[model samples]
Target chain A: MDRIPILKIGAALLVTIQVDLHDSVAMALEEDLSNMIVKAGAKGVLIDISALEIVDSFIGRMLANIAGVARMLDADTVVVGMRPAVAITLVELGLSLPGVKTALNAERGMALIQRRVAESGLEADHAAGEF
Target chain B: MRIRQIVRAAALEAGLSLVDQTKIITAASELARNTLDHGGGGHASIERLQEGGRRGVRIVFEDTGPGIPDVDAALRPGFTTGRGMGLGLSGARQLSNEFSIATEVGRGTRVTIARWK
Candidate 1:
């Protein structure tokens, strides 16, 4: 079977996980992504879920957990390209990761991350009154 | 066998990339198995929908087994009522775009999910 693949971009890492988002695999994938972010020293992570059809509670929590771990590693996480039905299911199920950012597409997600990085730097410079 | 095949086929037909289709299939298989194992048996249906020019697929799994008494607790991550890892409901909810559940004591449980193409 073709399992999920981790795609690395320049500085920004994209983990293209295409898992059934089911039971055991869901848990395992969450752990795997968490470890990968820490080990890779990636500055940003994008989760492309354009393929998923369902979103259960365990999967929701796991995604949130992965995001938490990535943040601890100083890598931002963005979920991208979810189908509308899948989005509705997640909301109906009451499974959500509040505060975790998401984008309609991967490109936008990457751009958002870049902007965050730039904004943080600009804010620090301004605090020091640096031009 | 039919359920498994249906799940797999539906995942692919739903426009999930090959890798994502597999993930969705896996999730559906596990959930279908649980329906048989825990619910004693159930029926699932799949269909395609187009809303506002966007396409997607929806799957509904319904069972007449003993209704879950504490749905809130049952949905907790890592909590299982069966011997298996309690990831079925939770996992399925994660892999799709929408998930909804309706059930009553001694009646039945109905789960609806959709994944857009």
Candidate 2:
């Protein structure tokens, strides 16, 4: 099975989704990301979806799922680089991914994550809850 | 769905705007998945069109299987025979300019959708 790489940067994790994900692959990614956050004591996750050509209802649900789980794990997930085409499709598919924050690109996403973490408080408070 | 990608390309080649390109491609994806999942795998066809002084793209997904018993029920959101959210049929319909479905129980199913440029 192909695995999407999760790169840990400082207190954050960055993932670039460049494949047309099969259902199992997407499920694996969600699991992998959850485990990585606990092990790394990460505060943020930045997922880039610009390379994906389409965002169906299934894929839309997957994004929301990742965000939902990440929040429960005490991490902020920012889905970044959504192309104009994907944005239009997702809306029509009846999914807005309400809980997932988004950014124009990776740089801005990183900034958003950093700002969020800063406002929430420093590392020790959240790190102690790590799994 | 590979057909989704192809249909999107065809819609683009037909000179539809960026938004329409995505919308048509998304519709094709939902229908193609239905053909494969419910119809036990099938094929699809896509074509560029110029009809009635308008340009657009059309895609047809066909499968020979236990066809839909009631299309009306299938078109309702959150209705599914499987463990899915059942947004494919209804969401796809909402995304296209033109959508049509034909199915005969125990024979086959065919869904055709188009979007004008």
Chain A TM-score by candidate, in order: 0.76, 0.89
i-RMS for every candidate:
7.3, 1.4
- Tell me the TM-score of chain B in each candidate: 0.87, 0.94
Q: What is the two-chain DockQ of model 2?
A: 0.71
Alpha carbon deviation, residue B15, candidate 2 (Å): 1.5
TM-score on alpha carbons, each prediction = 0.55, 0.90
Give the CA lDDT, 0 to 100, for residue B12 in model 1.
66
Among all candidates shown, the one with the greatest TM-score:
2
Model 1: per-residue Cα lDDT over A1-131, one tens digit each:
23456776644567665655545665666666667766755667888878665554445666677788888888788989877766765554445685477999999998886776676563342224322
Q: Which digits, one per residue and each the tens of the lDDT, describe model 2 over residues A4-24?
A: 899987678999999888889
List each candidate's DockQ score. 0.11, 0.71
Residue-by-residue lDDT tens digits, candidate 1, B2-107: 6656765766665666445545554565567667877789998877667886766677888999878888876675678765556677767766678788877787
Ten contiguous residues minimizing lDDT sum, candidate 1 chain B: B18-27
